[model samples]
Target: MRVSREQVTANREQIVVNAAEQFRRRGFGDVTIADVMKAAGLTHGGFYGYFDSKQALEAAVCERGLAESVAAVDAVRDGEGGEGTAAEAPLRRFVDDYVSARHRDAPEEGCTVAALACDAGRSGPELQQLFVSGITGMAGSLAGLRGQGSAEPAEDGGPDFATLSTMVGAVILSRAVAAADPELSERILAAARERASAPVE
Candidate 1:
């Protein structure tokens, strides 16, 4: 029985979703096509029919995961009517939620940017472009909420780099120290929260 085109599309989508979760949990270098296929409940042989290579699947994952991450952040911002005080602003609230232990403890369900940053730096050109474009999308979404809506960020995505850097860096460090020094992890998160929560002059 041949599968319909719609089924194939659905299967590919499922594989990308499963791959995204597994990649976040296990990192990009560790996950295999078989792992993603198994997670998707599909046979391993069917992997190639869906993706040319692991890198291809990674490109799909990057697109889906980064868009989802951006949507999550935008939801946090848009949910508050986009009209809050500095302390209650979208950027501040996003930082509070993003830097919290809840996000730090749950890599599989957390930010794709932090989850994939380690691998993107050394990826091939195609994957690198995907990361570059996707990151800019995420950063642009955050920058729009950074209280500089009227001002356009640089063409190279320099605006709000500190905000994204602090969020991603703090989460990375907190996760790194979480197993060895949990208290220090909390402090790291707190510091980021405080920094982002500071009032704009």
Candidate 2:
């Protein structure tokens, strides 16, 4: 059966979206093309029509995952109510959302960086580059938030890389620690949020 170009485009996007969610929920190594195709409600044989190889599908998934994450950060940084919302409001929203237990428990819907950075570390260069770009972009957004509220010229006049790292690290650690020590997990998140909100020197 011949698929219309519009339907083909939609099908391809569906596969990538489903694959991204699966990769975020499970590690990249754990999700197979069959699993992704099944999740997308498509036949396994049709997978090759959209992607030349699993690696190509993975690259597509990586880009989609990173795009989802980047969009979330952008929404927070730009504020939902358009201009005039307090500059600090969006940053606060991001820190709170990013470090919350909800985010920790919901890998499929959360930041890809927190969900898959460790997995990406061992993946191909293209995927790793996507991870790096996602992290860098996120940090840059947070740094811009920090700069708006700082009295000084923002030190080197860039984003606060440490705070952004701390937020991402805290989410990963919190998820790891949550299964064993719930209190500690919450404490970790709280500390990261507090530290992120603190005035930069």
Candidate 3:
């Protein structure tokens, strides 16, 4: 029987969402189209009905993950009074939650930047573009946290690309280190939060 248009659309979205999470958890190179289709509860034969190819789907998944990451940061900022400057409370919360064992153990739901950055180097141009946009969005979110009189230059002096890269790298490395030593993980998390909340000197 032919499936309804709505069902097809829903199925496609399900595939993308599942693929995004899987890619985030297992790196883009490690996940197969069949794996994504199976996780989405659909047959592999029907994969092309949704995506032209796995590359196409990977691009879609990257976009989806990027949006989700930005949304998470947005949620945190919204809860904290929309103040543009990574202050103590929100920054602390982000560092604690992001570097915790929980985030490390759950790669599928973790931050895409930390989960996929290494693999992104091998991705196609389309996927690379998605990473670029995602990084830009993340930097924008971080830049918003600076206070009014900080006198930091926007986009550069502020928590721009380099700063954001450091933050993501720190979280990723902390998670890796945490796997062997719980105490080290806790220390890394605390140190990251302290640094994130500290004023620029």
Local distance difference test, each candidate: 0.79, 0.80, 0.73
Ten residues in a row with the worst lDDT in model 3?
Answer: 146-155
Q: Where does candidate 1 stray beyond 4 Å?
A: 80-87, 148-158
Estimate, for each residue in 1-201, the C-alpha lDDT of model 1 and write its tens digit.
899999999998899889989998888889988888998999999999998889888888887888887787677667643233555666666777788898899999888888888888878888788777777776777776665433334345554666677889999999999999999999999999887555443
Among these predictions, the greatest TM-score belongs to: 2
TM-score of each: 0.87, 0.90, 0.84
Q: How close is candidate 3 to the true structure, as a TM-score?
A: 0.84
Better of 1 and 2 by TM-score: 2
Candidate 3, superposed: residue stretches over 4 Å from native: 80-88, 148-159
- Clashes (N, CA, C under 3 Å) per candidate: 0, 1, 5
Candidate 1 residue pairs in clash (backbone atoms < 3 Å): none
Better of 2 and 3 by TM-score: 2
Model 1 clashes, total count:
0
Candidate 3 lDDT by residue in tens digits, 83-188: 3345445544554566556776777878888888888888778789899888888777656644332324344554456546656776787777776887876677
What are the per-model C-alpha RMSD values against the true structure?
A: 3.6, 2.7, 3.5
